[model samples]
Target: MESGQGLGELIPPLADSDYYLDHYDDLSCIITQGLSGKIIVNGQPYEEEMLALNNISLAELSNLINYMNSQWYPDKIEVNLNTIKAQLANCAD
Candidate 1:
């Protein structure tokens, strides 16, 4: 539930105000395909390549998403299996 702890200030924090507000929709892609280069989180820049987490099952991912949303965001966003599958299908390499 705690955010703002990256890899020695290299990688961006997974949860942040600007990130959850702006790139919330990209969560599926980021989880499936990983993210590289720089991204702005809470007005600060972070540069690193987060490894893909595609090995986990859809159920696990859905549960993780739900937990994260409940902990970080104001509104609850329940992620279903179908939604996760659909979003993952559209992920870019």
Candidate 2:
């Protein structure tokens, strides 16, 4: 997906990563919780403090929740699930 790159080109490079190859939960964390905060995302900066990770979009949130439910991480799951769930639940149906 890189500039001027084909799908095959991308796969070969990423094939070396253990994080990419296994530990699929790591991606879930990155997608759900994101890599950083300070940047406003999903109305999070105004809503509340998110420690380091400040935002994830609603679609991303949905993916994350589903991912969490699918994979079992025991004690390491959900660093910010409560806040996200609270915000989402308050949304109009």
Candidate 3:
């Protein structure tokens, strides 16, 4: 989690509500199809290119997303298989 700490380039903190809240909806797409270019999280800019996890099956990806939401975001949001599927279907790959 502690990569640079207010110094240089940073990995968007998934545990921070500010970051998660803004990108949660598109998180699934980002995870599945990968993300490039620049993204602002909590006003800080990150230009990291996340590699797509397309090698995994839908069920595994769903489980990972669900686990992350439950752990990091708690009851704020929930991602089911259908939701992941829909997100993947709409992903620009």
Candidate 4:
């Protein structure tokens, strides 16, 4: 878990569900578990220690996705507008 470690490298194996659930926040836990599932489904060797980090359930990911979609659209628009404004200012000078 050092700075700049890739996320896939930090995920725990499917066997360590309890450990993962205890440490991470709900959203992070869900994403981590989802990633772990992907690894397991793909037949990769899932790490065990990393499982001590996040244990999010399937229902939670659905809730998180809905929440994120609600929040993301407005923020995306604002960011695009700001970027355009900044570019326009740069061109003006």
Best by lDDT: 1
Q: Model 3, 23-53: lDDT tens per residue?
A: 6667677777788899887788898887887
Model 2: residues with Cα > 4 Å off, grouped in runs: 1-52, 73-93
Query: Which candidate achieves the best TM-score against the true structure?
Result: 1
State which candidate, 1 or 3, has the greater TM-score: 1
> Would you estimate the TM-scores of all the predictions?
0.80, 0.26, 0.77, 0.25
Pairs of colliding residues, candidate 1: none
The lDDT-based order of candidates, best leading, equals 1, 3, 2, 4
C-alpha-based local distance difference test score of model 4:
0.37
| Tens digit of per-residue lDDT, candidate 1, span 17-54 | 67865766667777777778887787788777789887
RMSD, candidate 3, Å: 3.1
Q: Write the per-residue lDDT of candidate 4 for residues 42-65, one digit (tens) a residue.
A: 344454443432354444544543
- In candidate 3, stretches whose alpha carbon ends up further than 4 angstroms from where it belongs are 2-8
Q: In angstroms, how far off is 70's CA in candidate 3?
A: 1.7
lDDT at 77, model 3: 61
| Tens-place lDDT digits, model 2, residues 9-81 | 2121222233333534344344444343243222223223223233666566655545544443333444355
Model 4 regions more than 4 Å off: 1-30, 33-53, 74-93
Tell me model 1's lDDT, rounded to 2 decimals: 0.73
